[model samples]
Target chain A: MSDIDVAMARALLLARRGPSSDPNPRVGCVVLDDAGEVVGEGWHEGAGSPHAEVAALARAGTAAHGGTAVVTLEPCGHTGRTGPCTAALITAGVARVVFARPDANPDAAGGAQRLRAAGIHVSQIEDLGLRTEADALVARWQQAQDLGRPVVTWKFASTLDGRGAAADGTSQWITGAPARQDVHDLRADADTILVGTGTAWTDDPRLTVRDRRGADRPQQPRRAVMGLRGLRPGSVLERTGATVLDTRCPHEALRRLWALGSRHVWLEGGATLAAVFWQARLVDHVVAYVAPAFLGLGAPAVADLGIGSIDAIARLRLDDVTRLGDDLRLMLTPTPDPTEGA
Target chain B: MSDIDVAMARALLLARRGPSSDPNPRVGCVVLDDAGEVVGEGWHEGAGSPHAEVAALARAGTAAHGGTAVVTLEPCGHTGRTGPCTAALITAGVARVVFARPDANPDAAGGAQRLRAAGIHVSQIEDLGLRTEADALVARWQQAQDLGRPVVTWKFASTLDGRGAAADGTSQWITGAPARQDVHDLRADADTILVGTGTAWTDDPRLTVRDRRGADRPQQPRRAVMGLRGLRPGSVLERTGATVLDTRCPHEALRRLWALGSRHVWLEGGATLAAVFWQARLVDHVVAYVAPAFLGLGAPAVADLGIGSIDAIARLRLDDVTRLGDDLRLMLTPTPDPTEGA
Candidate 1:
């Protein structure tokens, strides 16, 4: 592989070490000396921290002069929480720069143009036939920017026959321990965990991410309950501070979540809430935990979404399948409607 | 590997070429000369055909003197269609023999004892530290012998939400093309395909195995309709010569099928019929084709089976998982209850 390919791969690895739930993109930078010897490396910790380029330049010090910097994303030219990365690179006397992805945020654009005007050579990582590996690291943030709303991932656990609860509505444990732990990981990565008032009142879920040993994680997603129904006094959700969005409309609840700066929302809603989101075509992703058991009678996992025939059935493309203990975790995405865009 | 291991592997391969739906076990045999060279090979075609040992001995002719016979099953000592295989082996001057599985049928066993009584050296294939590879070839037959009835495999196709049909009862296609073709192959391997009058009248299914190109296979399984309700006159099942069991009890239906010599029964019954069998614990195996689509409102793939609480839910052990185009084929078996047997 070429030097650019090796450096880009290392940069991508470093980018993933950053906090996932942060609104800012994860970026990593590597500064190579003129002779291509080792120098310095740094990754953005989170928002309000120094950018990757500035951190790497500080670590390089005098060695950064006439050195080349390879980064996972374009160096920002506009100042936000910190100063412009392009100005830091110029002051560090970097001779050449390579970046994997262009800045898609309007406020962060024009970084490459600024660097070139400063008499430094700048080239795209694609020029060397190296694809960006950091796209998934910032996919949710970028999608939120594109849609102007939090990217919704609807998650549910049910038996293999799709029963969410028994006849008496006792749904405490549908899946095994490992599948439940996997959902905790998903919750830890999201900025918000959402449920409906029915779920909050009936199930009284704590709506918090917990470790394998049942201890609460240091970083917890904001919990939100949607629907107009009033929650019971001293419910688990009320006991543990949760935002209550008083709205029956899925779009309105999502808009409220977006206003709260929630980039990715883990929707742990009940059947009715899920059906509404599905009918509104607002669910961006689906995570299903299927237990290897059969409950021949129970509440269905999903309610009616207005589909009355086979032709109108909602189809999804299976993206990933993982065996979690005695259960199966399937990740899927909705197949785009061909007639809608036209 | 030893000489016996090599010969036994080849014998197992030959055994699989026999018809799967036959009542008789598939057996293969290989004759080896004193110099350890294979002189003859043969496999049982089906019932009413020459046994594998006789066929191989016929081909070996004069070369069988003082030779070894490696077989997938013990040579039958008591015969119905032909003479005992032990007599033929002893008459042919076979000096030694090695067999994989001992004959389990009471009426046809004792081949090893008979051979030893005739002063011929007989040993088991396990003595060579090799596993019997032909067990699956005759598993259905052996299971039927043990249970005193046909082994039941309930097959169903449904959407991801466990819906077998839309709200209006339109259930033409739930799974993709590949999964449907797989069901046909299963039907070809079974001795009988069974349904209830509900399915017979509503769906009007032909209940015939067909190839991928929609041509009917030559060896079609016997079709049976089991329910108290009589099928409509000139319905597809009645016109196609399906047997009417006229029973609502799962046990009685199975007893009737056993008397008809149906060793493996593939049940393609509707939801209500499936629930009754499930409640009676008559389902031995399950084959579920899960399509990657969702019908939020519809008839559940399974109806109430008296399961009211999570503790009463029926649990199954996942045996195998296979992807069939846009669907998944899951093979599962019921977990035996510990309390009932004791």
Candidate 2:
């Protein structure tokens, strides 16, 4: 394979590290000898383990001399649980290094500079395809690091007209089965799932990640409920494992989750709770699964957001749109532009 | 080109006939001689014109003998303003015929059967690409013929959150200039543009078809207002020439327009008027231009449709989703399932 093909493969390997690699970016490495044959491959499997470059170098051993390393992310220069990858590569006598994405973390950045200082050839591949894949895999962690809070993704299921439930509150299945399955996949990517106390009492949902076969996923997001109201005893959420916080503030809940080393938080609350997050300007992303039906009455997907006029309304930037069965899923993010203040 | 390629070319020619061919399907034909060289090409330019096959046969003249005809639609077997195209093709001694789509109109079908019985080589291309193109070009007129009423396309511009205006009713430019330009394109395709009397009094809009250059288009849909209330004498829609119906009934207004040979109606009324048509089951199509901005406290795109509960909500089938500048344009149609009751 060419350098880009090998980098993309390394990106796939990095992604295999899964959501367990929170608070740290997933990294993958492949060592190639003089003949461009892959001699060893390794990924940063979990926290407090050997760095991907160090693991790859150990496997390559003598083959690492006068060889090139292709990595999904730029090698880290900072020493954490393991030694810095840059020092290990130089110690292994690596000749060249090619990476798909630059490590955005300030402490881990300077690997290219250190390698070049040691007279090693270091190249950053501007391949958009592989770089995009690697960037998306690390976006939540990067956002958490940049914003100093857990990146919150607010998810809701609504009718095509934006109604979340009927006047009588009968919203058993707004979207079909395929869209619900997609939500489970989304849950698997987050480290925490949160709902309001009203939802915990009304729906009594056990927010565990489950696959299509109804089996528990290997990694499940920690279930959390936020609100002053206490949960009913022996409720599904209370019976099944959920962290009940006695606070109504969205930021406080996020801070607590961040303290617990959560990088991503999926919020699946009702309209009133969504408005609270919107008012607090804590919602980073919005995922709305719009079913192909209309409820002229019932409830709006989001309650009045303290927006009495049009100019005060919060605007969301559209990221992606997909059709899942008869439903349309729209992924949006809070606009980065500060002029449109939340 | 192969037969399918030649048929696709004919479909493009048919589309070139444009929206002027309302009340009749646009069609194009190309005749190829035994040597496989194109002999003639023609398209149905207007409703009263000779059918595509007859026009092509006229152009081919004696060159049509022992030639194959490629048509966007099957040759018409029934007579209308002109003689049957199938009889003309057989009289012209065309040896073989290939068509992209079969004639679905009840009065116009049986052309393939007649050709086969007359010892002519008839082939249906079954090319979904070209057939879909031709079918969409005539869907409104075909639906009108089937339902015996003008096909109503209810169009409304809203914010991304589905608000039609601000709290103070300032809705001058909810969508960007590009989405408004697209609305004019939609208007140019319809035979009538209808609004409520309240909208006529409040907005005073000149519902004329205009191009991007701000010049009036060659053809304009007739402006119509449906409500019991009278329009202000000096209003734009009143002074600019609009038909003010005396009745508040949606069905009565549609009957009047259909009697005037209108095949498609573009409804751009306010919330109340839309609810009337929706509840009456008169709205067949919906075109929602969703702006990227939000207006939480303005007007909802649709009002109550007597849907007291979620189960009674009207469901729509998604047809198209498009981006116009920073806005989203969604084209949808009412679900055809009988259980939906609309």
Candidate with best DockQ:
1
True lDDT of residue B193, candidate 1: 92
Q: Give the TM-score (0 to 1) of chain B in model 1.
A: 0.88
In candidate 1, list every pair of residues with a backbone clash.
none
For model 1, residues A1-342, the per-residue Cα lDDT tens digits are: 678778888888888777665667789899988888658888888767888888888888989899899998988877443236899888999999999888878888888888898899998886434443666667888888898888899998888888999887777688999999999988887888989999898888898999999999877889999988967789988877799999989889988888776888899879899888888889999999988788888998878878888877788998888889988888999887533565
Return the TM-score for each candidate structure. Answer: 0.91, 0.80
Residue B86 of model 2 has an lDDT of 87
Misplaced by over 4 Å in model 2 are A2-15, A29-104, A108-133, A336-342, B1-137, B337-342
Chain A TM-score, cand. 2: 0.88
Q: Cα lDDT of model 2 overall?
A: 0.80
Error of 2 at A143 (Å): 1.8
The per-residue C-alpha lDDT of model 2 at residue B16 equals 65
Model 2 has how many clashing residue pairs?
0
